[model samples]
Target: MLTKQDVHVLRTLLQEYAHAASLPVNQEKQRLWIKLNHLHMERPMVLIDQIPWNEMDVDGSLRCLVADTYWRQVEDNLRCTLYKFRHMPADMVLNPYVCLPRPIHNSGWGIEPVSSRHIELEMGSTAPSREFVNQIQSLDDVERIKIPQLTLDEKREAQIIQEADEIFSGIIDYRLTGLCMHLGIWDSIAMWMGVENCYFALMDEPEMIHALLEKMTEGLIDMIGQMNRQKLFDIHSHVCHCSQTFLEDMPKENDLPLSGNAWAFGLAQLFTSVSPAITDEFEVQYMKRVFPYFGAIYYGCCDRLDDRMHVIEKLPKIRKLSCSPWSEREHFAQVMPRYCVMSNKPNPAFLASGKLDEQLIRDDIRRTIDAAKAHNRNLELILKDISTVNHNPSCLWRWQEIAMEEVQR
Candidate 1:
């Protein structure tokens, strides 16, 4: 039950969101994103995500006024949306209607790792120097990672809509949509045991690695199949890993599950040192089982995949290829097919410094823009994995401005 204050807070934000959505710039961004996604690009696009919202403390932007924990989250979201629009809205679409996540509970894959040491940083965010606890040592131990089952609570889901409607009866409407499904098998393996152990096992116990991967692969496929069978693949994903995803290809009006309508994000970020053939054998082969089921796939993350394109390209339905800061941008721009959207993930480390280097950030964006321009590739700049902005919110605002200037140039 939302109090009058909660309803007032929500309705106020709803009016602002509705007004922002009515703007022509958002529609133009939608056009640019659709063109880039379809590989019919006139110019480059920019998107910033994985932002450090904790640090964006300007005039109570992040401070929630609501009382209830759940409603406070709703208030926080509305506040953040309006804040981003005012601050550094890159190429993201400000959708008019409100969206509520369906109450879907997942009986997760049962494996937990331990975090022992914490490192407080002077510049970056505090992180855990996790105790690389090995949960999988034997072949039978892999059986512990179960196939995740999802249960959608319809009553709760309806209650949320009813509550939202009673609050925003004439303002903005709401929809129950799911989020993007990212399938990273090796990432899961790294989480369960340890990233270092994952590499060591590949060399020392290759058979064990294969067995573990095989089970995990089967488990993920089972999860996807269950979602499809349950009609739970309906996602209204605006972006997948900071890359714009709204496109004509991913039909909005579809009958079959969104497995064949939306995108599936995949990556093996720690596969940086592994050879193409080895990655192909261990990672790609297994992940491809989960890939073919999706309408489209956006592959790679912070990994330098320029050299590994031979193996990387083997995965079917790959529309977006991540060209991270480590990736040889020129090589990827020249090598990747013109049809594939080159999602150039710019490094956010510059902002983590004591002071922002405008020229350095400018040069980075310039280099990527040049690479894409030279090869005539479909390009989109994505700044992600930002842990901290050195307590300065202007770091990101300036970054988006520079990125937008570069792309629009």
Candidate 2:
């Protein structure tokens, strides 16, 4: 449902990729096309507020040697705008998904390095120390001298074929760009398994947290079967970002095909800073066993959005369900009238204070288009970036002309 010259040729190719990211050899393809150009489109909701939050380390026990030189200057300004967006072809821009290498999950899994010099060598240790989980189970680039290529199993199978070639190159650019292909790379493997070992590990030890989340979901299905053996891999779009931590029934039926991926899923609920009855006992029982491995699914991400609106009112083939910025815009316009497509984020300190206060950003874009035009459906507002906010890019080209005049009146 995106007409109007396909949102004016995606707001003129995201304002000529944000004016070629303030030039300088297209600053790493304008910071990975301004944070993965809304996952190269197909209703991949983005509002824009610039958020890196010191490259998030929710519990990997910080100390990325002074934040890996500002995350390699935002991955050399996103591989200089993906080598000037011929969608990455300048000698495959060092393709390992452009920039890949990671580890530091309790020092690549043996657990217990909660840092600050392992809390001053476990100060008054009482237990929970087999030499502090065997010195955070395996970290050797000379005892974890800040996790550079310690070859965590061949750089996690080349970062799962560089995140399955960004969802098989966005389903081959959504069949030559019809649009709606926003892949987030399964929350970048849940930020390399450190959202508290991907959510509390069955409250810490349900058979050693289901044998380390089933050997990290069988090394994420052998890095998504080497990202479905690269070359053009099938294209079905509809994958969003963040959310996952299951536990309740703890996947038994032959661990639901190694926990998810048929294609199409989305969730946001950033573990609501824990405790909404432990985010409904481990984020709604491991996302109801990864919701039928998806056709489409979504839940909140930024603010609890009424604690995952009762698991987005039981998502089956969810089409889009965020309301966040701490939802309740008239109870998400009366509970997302007719199950799905709401989005509506708006609030990265009101688009990062570069104050052009066009009557307070056109009265918050006319109260989010009169609250999603009386909730018939489909709204879309998202200006994210919750931590270390910083981006403005003329408030993402003036909120794409105030979200195309509130999704066309």
Candidate 3:
């Protein structure tokens, strides 16, 4: 049961969402995004994310006003969506629909970190100092990692959607979005065994590392099958892994459900110092187990992946290549194939500093633009990993202004 206040707040947010969805710009954006993803863009597209969103403003514009805990999350999402478009509106598309997770929950991998310590420089930082008590220290320890059992609440799922439709009828649609995966086989393993423990094992205990990854990879592949079997894969989902999915080529007539339309995101953040040969042997090899199940794949993250593009580009169904702040612009731009979109991530540290250094932002974006032009490759600016903006949200507005100008040029 919603309180009068909850009803008022939700209704107000829905009104704005409906109005925004009706705007002509969304249709225009959807078309451009499709062209960009197809690697045939007339110009570049720009977007910003990975924000410390909750702390963007002290003015309470970013504050959660709803009383219910669950509803508060809905309120937060709505506020951020409106705040984002109102401020930047840089190539972001809004729909009259909001996607909700399917009513599916799971019992996680049975093993837990035995011991760990961590400290953060600031609240809400995604990175922090950490240590772990290596849980998988030997060959036998691989058995301790268990596959999570999944449960679907179909009755509850129907109930919630029906209720949402009843509340927001004719105003907005509440659609259910299903699971798309980012293969984090290595990330989970690194935490169970310490990060250094895993890396050292690559050299010191290569056999043990291989045994662990194989077991972990098998479990994840199995999980994907189970999720698909439950009819929980949503390929047309608007947002995927912090980026947008523009094309909607769903499974044709009898095509395999996920195999025809689904996507898999692949990355190994710990491969910073590892060589291309070792990365292929460990990360890429295991990831290939599930690659055939998806029609396309987006690969890489914050860790420097430029040096090893030759290795990953050969992986099956490679679509988008993430160009991180550390990736060499000219080389990656030149070498990245025309079939894939180079998603260049600008350094958010420029925005994180005590004050905005406008010149640094210009230089970074200009370098990316130049690199893309030099190679005649299509590039998209995805400014992310933004942990802070010194409590001044206006910096993002400025960034949008600067980046939009550069990309359009």
- What RMSD, rounded to one decimal, does every model reach? 1.9, 22.7, 2.2
lDDT score for residue 44 of model 2: 23
Candidate 2, 142: how far from true, in Å? 44
lDDT of 2 by residue, 14-60 (tens): 34434443345434433332232222322222334334333322333
TM-score of 1: 0.95
Q: What is the TM-score of each candidate against the true structure?
A: 0.95, 0.25, 0.93
Q: Output the number of the TM-score-best candidate.
A: 1
Indicate the residue-level lDDT of 110 in model 3.
85
Q: How do the candidates rank by TM-score, highest first?
A: 1, 3, 2
What is candidate 2's local distance difference test score?
0.41
Query: Model 1, residue 160: displacement in angstroms?
Result: 1.1
lDDT of all predictions: 0.81, 0.41, 0.78
- Any runs in candidate 1 off by more than 4 Å, and if so which? 122-129, 254-257
| Model 1, span 282-360: residue lDDT tens | 9899987889988888998988889988888888999999998888999989888666899998888888863778899
Cα-lDDT of candidate 1: 0.81
